[model samples]
Target: MGQGQQEQVATSLAGAVSEEISASLAPVDAELERRYPGDPGTRQPVHTVYVPGDAFAVDTIRSWGEKALTALDTHAPDAASFAAVLGLSDELAEPVHARVRAKLEHEPIEDLRVDFEDGYGPRPDVEEDETAARAARLIAEAYQNGTAAPYMGIRMKCMEAAVRDRGIRTLDVFLTGLMVAGGLPEGLVLTLPKVTYAEQVTAFARLLEAFEKTHGLDSGRLGFEIQIETSQSILATDGTATVARMIQAAEGRATGLHYGTFDYSACLGVSAAYQASDHPAADHAKAIMQVAAAGTGVRVSDGSTNVLPIGPTAKVHDAWRLHYGLTRRALARAYYQGWDMHPGHLPTRYAAVFAFYREGFEQAADRLARYANRAGGDVMDEPATAKALSGYLLRGLDCGALDIGEVARLTGLTRADLEGYAAPRRGDLTASTK
Candidate 1:
């Protein structure tokens, strides 16, 4: 067609959509906005370290860091030795090892939970109350003194009939203590364990609502991780996915859905000897949790391994290899977080995390840089791919895996630029040309 004809055709096509169609679909657009809000674009801790409530103390964080360092000193005293144990590549060994050591010295534990559930077991009401209050005091002091982890809170007992009342009382004591101390810290986190039904999640949300009302805080001020530790939590008796319902039931108060490796595996009748996070049963449950949490601002975390890296050097090496392999495997599967049950697990955790990001750092940065500049490359990139690339680097930066200077140098984009690309509004992601 002639240029004049083409110009006329383009003008005619500009307003082809009817007002009736847009008006009819308005509610659907609102529903879509409400339902899938995408990621919150905040820092997600790579692991949550659990300590029994009664066992928690002011020195717990430092103690864990010290113990992890001690383990490194005893088992693998040098980078080469540690790399040999984990079979890290020559290119990654020195940098990954140095970063792991620095991370251990500075921020060994990212997220910590003072466990009142299985780890604490059942305690006398009076003793539990005192312990709960003590935990609050210590945690508050830690934050005040600038010695706290990035995230810290309690894992209260589940809402099961046998322990529901105790759990409520403990949470009340803890939060009330925090309020009395100096108001809640921004780093506070909570975990609700062994949830099986959506109604239980609703009940938990209601409990939080009541607390907020009592404290004069804004509604939805509290959010907790829902622990998926039962088979029923994955698949209801009626065959619908109960985890999805649980997320919705949280009423915008769900921060994460954390898999419970042992509890979940045992619920499926997996033998104790065979129970592990990488087990088929555990994978299935976590996969469902991941899908349910996608685009809901709720993160998914994998469960922990019971194996402790202690005793003889040979035994500890074996345990380190196991932990390192599992951590790498989880990262590969996009399960960026997990649970750490011991101080010894810290070394391997950082090592695996650092290696994962560093190995792919150049490729991710190059692709994102290309997309940012809109430069043509061998690969055809889209906005979604760019978002993923930016997210990967952002996560790496958040967890000490990548430095901001290096990221900026490679991508030629600042942190604010990365955040804009990583967390664009729903429709903005796809509205731009490749």
Candidate 2:
């Protein structure tokens, strides 16, 4: 048959089986509905600093941010020193030096995570509950006194068979203690590391539900992040992508999926010395995660660089240079969130972030101005592009890259306009321009 005739015949036949097919596929449709990934959040922190849980204290985290500032002021006090630490060419650094300095001075750490996994490796059983208690007390105190970061959380051990008991016990104790002592704060996330299966995530969700009910909290008050640290998390035995399944299994409590660079690389048999965030295998896995989580409200984060900023001597300029490059690579991939291992990593983190946002500030501002004026000469300023430009400026403003006056001059919008801004309204653009 001719192609058109064949298609017409197929369509006619399809109508005959449509009702039966729909009935037969009802179960499949239900599965798909169950597997739907939820929304991706509007904003995500740029970095999550990991402090070993055993050694965790709110005062210490606060102090680390303070110490990072002092270190920046002491070591990279001037533009020359700042340029040297980040290894920026004098010409490249000259423009952003002031912005970097201001960011370091104001907000050194964007997020902090108290890690109980690798960072707190195999503590004594007795010590675990005490540590959990301490963490709970400090968490409550930070909330009351306003000493915490904008985002903070605790990374429990993996949910695999090996550490499942320890992991759940630690979480239960920490949470029970947190509630009894005072209350959990907003923006708190529980980190479940080394997730290898969807069942584990579903179980964690159940745990969150139980915790909520027991503590008289909201149903989804206790959200958690899953770590994509193993090959199994990226692909299943049947060779299908497991990320979607993992997100489905979270049942709406999964806040983000974090990449554990060293563990993920080691799982792929990458050499210890060569394992890095930009590894091809790591990149592939993160790309899969990005695709799976795209528009699903589940944020995707890149893994950390294993290299520490500490050395035998106190000289850290070289170390900061390395850290900055690593962070820059993550930013290049659009993975704003990553793991921070040391206090020294703080300066380089902000330096790289501000540099990334500042580099495109001028172009974005000009594009947004023209687009907002409803004049897109030689530039395709669709609603999507305008929204992206507004988002860039919003993030820049949040990170202290540009202040209110700079935003007004660049985009011709007041702070309030941008704060509740979604996209350029069709009518607003037409009416104002007309």
Candidate 3:
């Protein structure tokens, strides 16, 4: 329940570092390699990626879109002029085929959401189901004809009326008409936007469950991911584990979890002011989530950086990428994957992903040398070995070297064997032997 062993840990770490300093001959990296032995590593990656985003989210139509994507890759702020925000048509419907077709053909776009096509809103707005039906017809026409082609995904309206009274439930008939008119799904995420607790997750699960049964839908545990963007969800210690338990409650029907950085920061009174992706407060929130869901099966990811850097110089562009990388790496260290709210941010998405996995593995490899005593048998105490091994194993999972089920499959001794038998030294031909 206590995700952190900090008071216990900080003291032990201080002691260990002191001891290591006193014993100057040992290479912190090498000394541990030899003292503890681990078995051969057959570790495969558990995370598919550490960064992801929407291909054609609203930001793309703006003049700064391209630069924004680059900024996401790095962390640089845009120094150039950005296009003014345009609402309505950008948020609402279009003028049928020629318009949609030209938008796809000439412009750089990848996907579109069928927003409010099927009407299911207030007594006045209950026609959202009809809107969904209309959108379905439009989408099917495009797919059948081949002019406007994109993998469509729609964000559903919130289920609660108190929330609905304030805002609109955008997509009412997506799932209802999904199999009927729109064909099958590429992927479905019931993007529960402002959930603050596990019970909200359970509520969503119940709805999905009952819906599937009533509709005779075959997928038993319909997977849906949660968005932890509320102050309540991120701040409460119970909030984090509650997410894992929610997924379990659904009997393994969870896709992924996303950090709603801006909304969460807003909920905490941090800001709707800064870019959502790279804020320091957001970083702390992400860290807490990571520790909370240490062994859960769900894949968690950091949210997107909101400020679109609209500049020209390559230097400025790369700087944006740098920030994106730092934020991404930090999150990856916490063991989260995926991001949202933009598509032009691909290069950043791809780059951060590699950096996280690579750096995490490299750091662990360096630490393993210390933990296992350089693959030799010289300088490790049992207690130090245990702590070191625990950090290594946990970090490996954080770095995505293992998953929850895999963690349970092996004993600590097995881990010790896989890590290294003793402190491994340079040119040690017998190193990695259990």
Candidate 4:
């Protein structure tokens, strides 16, 4: 109870804290430099890949959208699915955007997005205050909530010849609506649909860079997500490092690479009747994404599980649904965060996230504190001290158990190890391949 005793305890704890924080940090930096050798920011699988729900739900139309979305939620390959709910034109409904907005605000959407292409209806210029206000309302609602509002994104019409074949134009206006009316919410990641070539991404990024400058937003702050719908993006390019090459083409602007499964399978002449979520084409598409993200900052996400667990079998299918959710680890292995199509996938999303953090942060904290106390420069000894700590750093990363900064702070694992550690080395590859 005495002041002297209290002072000694406080001083002792503070010294311990100092020692702990110091020990792990030094080797963490050295290890990172040894492995990566360059910019850590540019490492593979940059952020988590966020999958939007609109591609699947939009076909059901805004009226039946919710029911369809809930079904996808139940059986999606992973948890935390991204959904695209667009704002309707003034002519369609007075506050047409409200329905879509409600789905995003209410549903378990990971990324809230909209379709802003001209044929998607409404020119950026003609929209009056009411339409703008409705659009703004949705954006504001998402932002104010801790939800990743819009994260601010727009899915522009496809640049692929296939989309043009459908007679869609006025793509330019989509960019304008997002920049001008949507007010370009911060941390915005644009979804460029049906990209057939790397040039499309470069062009779009350039357009965004111009807009960002004009609006006084930081140049290059706006990032991108690629829709792997076109056949060319998947096959035929820079063969081995297809994804890496694709990312290179993005000029470091690509944040995530998503599988447009339905369209992708369709592009390969796979019929909807025969096409299931596990089709070979879909598998190839995801494989490419994983390879591309290797050692990069980009994140790759698996596509949706098409079987909707909606009917009486929903109970029986829950097991399979949970099993399928493990695809999130596959994406995590690639260091990608979001996936396309399937808001129902949110559960798996959180599952992957929680599993990683559960051990990563806590274990990493303990290691760093221990290292700090020793005061010796040799943080890496052997058996108990070095390997045990390194095991946590490596295993935590491989299993999506820890993030880059955490291991980077402690055992000297490079950001690459943290980035590459999404899928820990598995002894049983045969059973684990999703």
> Whose lDDT is greatest here?
1
Local accuracy of candidate 2 as per-residue lDDT tens digits, 1-434: 76656453334475659889989999986665455433332457888888888778656765776777767776677777787667776755765677655655555566777777888989888998788778877877777777767777788888888888998998988888778867787757789999999999999999889989987897888888889999999999999999889988998888899998988899999998889887899889999999998656688898787666664424577778778887888877778778787777787887787787877888888887887677666677665566667777877777776677987987888866664444444333333322
**Root-mean-square deviation of every model:** 1.7, 7.1, 16.2, 14.8
Best by TM-score: 1
Decoy 4 TM-score against native = 0.54
Reference-based lDDT, each prediction: 0.93, 0.78, 0.46, 0.49
Flag clash pairs in model 1.
Answer: none
As for model 2, its CA RMSD to the true structure in angstroms is: 7.1
Candidate 2 local distance difference test against the native: 0.78
Q: Could you give the candidate ranking by lDDT, starting with the highest?
A: 1, 2, 4, 3
lDDT by residue (tens digit), candidate 4, 1-434? 76657543334366778778878697985654443232233322212223222232222222233544454444432222221111112332222123323443353343545554322543343442233333444454455554443244455556556454221223344344555554556645566777777777777677667766877877667678787776788766555544555677776677777776677887889988766445777767778777666445565655545544345534425633442354534534443344433333333343444444443455554554454344344343322343234444554454343456755566454644433432323222123211
RMSD of 1: 1.7
What tens digits encode model 3's per-residue C-alpha lDDT throughout 240-287? 445445445545555556677667777767745564556777777667
What stretches of model 3 exceed 4 Å from their correct place?
A: 1-131, 134-152, 164-172, 219-221, 235-245, 248-251, 272-280, 314-319, 334-336, 354-434
| TM-score against native, each model | 0.97, 0.84, 0.51, 0.54
